[model samples]
Target: MDKNYYITTPIYYPSARPHMGHAYSSIVADFFARFKRIDGFNVHFLTGTDEHGLKIQRAAERKKIDPQTFCDEISQTFRDLSKTLNLSNTDFIRTTEERHKKTVQHLWNELEKNDDIYLSKYSGWYSVSDEAYYSDEEISEKENVKIAISSGSSVEWIEEESYFFRLSKWQDELLKYYEKNPDFISPKSRKNEVISFVKGGLKDLSISRKAFSWGIKVPNSQDHVIYVWLDALTNYLSALNYPDTNDELFKKFWPASVHLIGKDILRFHSVYWPAFLMAAKIPLPKKVYGHGWILSGDEKMSKSKGNILDPLDIIEIYGLDPLRYYLIKEVSFGNDGNISQDRLEDCINSDLANNYGNLCQRVTAFAEKNCSSLVPDNTKFNDEDLVMLNKFTDNLDLIRTEIDNQNINYYINFIVSALFEANKYFNDQEPWKKKDDKDRLNTIVYTSLEMIRKISFMLYPIIPSSIEKALKIFNLNIDAINLESIAKHDYLISGKPINKIDILFKKIEKKHD
Candidate 1:
């Protein structure tokens, strides 16, 4: 089995401040990276900003600063966000970096050498906001303005000298590759969407923009800048020091395990990216998972709509872990999910405070009071205890499979159910009433402590800070966590002193007017 895994969050276009959608993608990628690491895989997780585009140039001009200065300021917010979101990304690559520019130019040269890129004139509707071109069919007139129907971004007809990638040449090859790798695009719906778009017929993609001075200059031409998407997508390879495929980072983690992107960019990743690699004779990433938007009410959050939700504001009121847990558990993966204040509060109260947090606090407190603040000794498992413990051990393989498939809903549902069942076991076993039967009391406390240990181990990726606090009862820090430990029922040492834990989550109080 290949134990090396590579994953990425799309290099964000940092024309503005970070928003909830950006936080969601970074958190999801971090969840996977942390999981893979705990599962003993050498994981490379990459994220950064796509700094070259007309929109960025325009935004910088509005602020009366140079583009690089503008990028330097905005890109730092994203880097700060990775830390805020607790991402485990190994590398953060900026397209403006010398290393990335070198890689993009190298890729362009490879495509040019293969006769897959040619000089041409581009005259079409282009959305500077999206940095994408729209064909006649994809554009619609709205109140006298041309707009890309998919994104509702305004487009203007532009005619300029350009270099084009022969995307049309790879249509059949892309379709065949899709047929060969059924899992290449996830959730089935996104895959079908890509196939339908490709079958509709692909046109040679405009790969250079002569009207902009804010991007990497086309190699040798010195007149046009590389198209933003082409320049942006190569960040994945550049982070691994590509063009030096023999480099240790590239050799270990090339052909990324997955690209976690928003659904709107499906065409770029599923279609153009693979085609570009096919032209360059490079291996394609194994999968592209296009997840849905984080909506504000019914509409997707966008600056023009004036509906962008600042994640920092939410983080201020509710700490990082609750926000992280809410996004992963509340939002159904691969489908648009709205972030409601009511729903978020409900999740934090019921799931975090009442279920998991309560279980940990109750178990540790009970052990401290009854078991002399130590791991209970001489645990004798009955059928009930065995059944509760085996929920995790018996399904370890299934859990691994679900995570690999990015069936995050399944993994979360399992944890939620386990949390509920563990609570029920404690209530029914009535450990408080077992004082006269000291032996039975010890067994119940031992089983409940083990339950807390296993669930916290699995949840370490989602809510690290809170779990770190919870794990102190065992003297285990973050480094001590591993998936394999969940299998051993005796993993907690007998008669070892256990520490007390404070409330993991405080219930949000509602105010009555």
Candidate 2:
């Protein structure tokens, strides 16, 4: 049986348009999903919108449209983003869907049966923007209005009949879980934050709201609606058709390989989501990776601040591949990365256009001119040839290990450094200067082409479209590309005709104001 690898981006809350932050999280998930597929794992990638919430409800009211209709429009934007970015997600779940409603209700029943739920009159400060309750300690006065200390979203005091999940009951168990599975939360810092929060003690969480009618109805209760977080997090399970444990997808992907999310929600995914699963007696996901934000200028991008960059504009200015590669390559996985057009262009021109792209264009253009546009025949292995090949072969395990660890920046930098070394090798060998010795020239060019081929395979996940074009220059097709194909040297068929030379990336001329 193929090893099942399930991954998910946090289902986006589509009260607003998709921004660079939304794009970053989804793209990272897509990269991991694509990498797993290339590594021969059966991958299930999930991304979608969290369509039901007070935020959506209030936004719809302000727009003078019904909530469902508003949600439909905004949710489609997320779907369009997935399509535009070439995400290989298996499902795009929505909270309003019948299938997801069923799953949430099923989970609610399981928690209820376990006595993890009870009704109580709730009076607390709630952030409508975050759709989350804040404790007295988590709230503070901001301009005379109570605000959530963490998110800075304005909160209103409310009293209502609500159903509460016994989150406090599982505090010790959660601590034990963290101790036993130290890596349950990623990036070390986020895990420490979660552990400290849980140790401070968990209060019973409000699982249902009587004030909002736009969300999933609680099982056996028409007046109460399931909390938006519960509905949203259930998307991971609902995509696999949970509640039917006998179902193939449910059994195979129940314990997700990873849940890719931004650091802001680490507490929800790491603390609440796992507690909910424990209440339901379902297996918790293997890892919850809370990646850092992509900032604009010096501050985090937000709609209110008017600093959010529209990903479509970025795509229109620079192609999708560059944007994708920039996020994964330039951004540290667990730290904030401030991105700008200048920084993006610099990385692309230096890394892709100058290094990777220049190597391919220079070598292939030479091959076309000298070898009659054909992959030259490599003769007996010389010491230089063996050393170059060894350099390419020796790093495969290390790259794979980094991929497994989700060390994305390390993985990307390793490939780039290898390409840089290959370029250095070409320069040192001086293949062009040996033109009079046809056999020696052919050997040198052949080695460089094979090294390019190896780099092409490794880079396919980050820059698939460009890599596809690079592979085609050697008359190679996408179907033949895989992890094992690059394990040995010279997988490219010699004497195969090279396609017309095409630059992988065009150098960007920076614009100054």
Candidate 3:
């Protein structure tokens, strides 16, 4: 059997437009999925909208549309984002879909059969904004109204007939699991926070909400709707055609390799999600990485705050790959990153346009001018030439390790730095000055072209279209753009005329109004 690697972005709640947060998770998942595919794994990348929730129900009410209509409209936006952002997702599963509803119901039934689900009257401070029931300690008073302390969302005290999952009963088991698999949750800080929350003790989770009817119906119960998190979390399984674990996709990709989620939802994924799986006799996903938010200034983005940065707007201004590169390069995966327009311009102008793109233009332009727009054969090897060539070969393992660890900044920063070194090598050699010495110039151009080829392969996942265009200059195809192909040098055919290529990244002018 081929090694299978399955990864998922948490199904985004579509109470509003998809923003940078939604884009961040999906992009990271896409990046890893592409990396794993190139690393020779059978990869399944899943991302979609979480449409069934009180938040959506209320948003739909205000919009004067049925929940499904509201969901469909918003869901389409997220689907479009996947395309606009160049995400190579294998599947996009919405909670409102029949396939997903069936899987969620099946899982609920399994939990009920195990006696881990029971009826109860649920009364607590509930954040409709959060779609979560919070204990008194987790809520605080603000302007004579209760709110969740963590999210500062308004909460209401309500009583409802509900189905409760025996989440508290598995406290010890969850602790043991965390201890045994220290890496089950990532970024050490988020893992510690989860451990502390579980250690402080868990209360049984109300898995059904009777207050609203805009969610997945509880199995065999019409009065109650299955909690949105429960319905939404199962998307990872549903996308694989679960309940029929005998299906080829399910059999091949069960127990997802990782659940890439936002840090705010860490408890739901790390605590409630695992306990539910344990109760249902289903294997847990191998890992859950709760990454931090992309803040729009000092504050976390909220519609009420009028601070949500629409990703489409950014893409429109900067194009897709620049936006992708900025997010991955600027944001520390497990910590909140404040994005500013100025910062974005500086990053793109310095890294993509000046450093990487300028190097490509100069070297390829040199080849065009002197080497007859054809790839030249290396004539002589010098210490600098070998060192410059070795940069790509020597760093392959380290790059693989960084990608595996989800240390994206390190991986991206290394690539940019290597390109800078290549630029320095170009300056030191001065291929333009050596035009009279055809042999030396050919050797320099050939060596530089190989370096560009290697970096382009590494860059394909992050900025696919731009890198594809860059590699096309050397007549490389998508099929030949993998680690194994780039592992060896001298792959570029000598005397093959290169294709005409445009500038990869045009410098962005900063706007100050």
- Would you estimate the TM-scores of all the predictions? 0.99, 0.97, 0.96
Clashes per prediction? 0, 0, 0
- Note the residue pairs that clash in candidate 2: none
Estimate the Cα RMSD of every predicted model relative to the unseen true structure. 0.9, 1.4, 1.6
Candidate 2 segments whose C-alpha is farther than 4 A from its true place: none
Task: Please give the distance, in angstroms, between residue 257's alpha carbon in candidate 1 and its true position after superposition.
Answer: 0.4
Candidate 1 lDDT for residue 116: 98
After superposing candidate 1, which stretches have Cα over 4 Å from the reference?
A: none
The best candidate by TM-score is 1
The local lDDT score (0 to 100) that residue 134 gets in candidate 1 is 95
Model 2, position 151, has a per-residue lDDT of: 83
Predicted candidate 3 versus true structure: per-residue lDDT over 373-428, tens digit per residue = 99898758688888887876788888877776788988888788888888888899
Shift of residue 60 alpha carbon in model 2, Å = 0.9
Between which residue pairs do clashes occur in model 3?
Answer: none
The regions of model 3 sitting more than 4 angstroms off are 511-513
- Would you give me the overall lDDT of model 2? 0.88
Error of 2 at 501 (Å): 2.5
In Å, residue 384's CA in model 1 sits off its true spot by 0.2
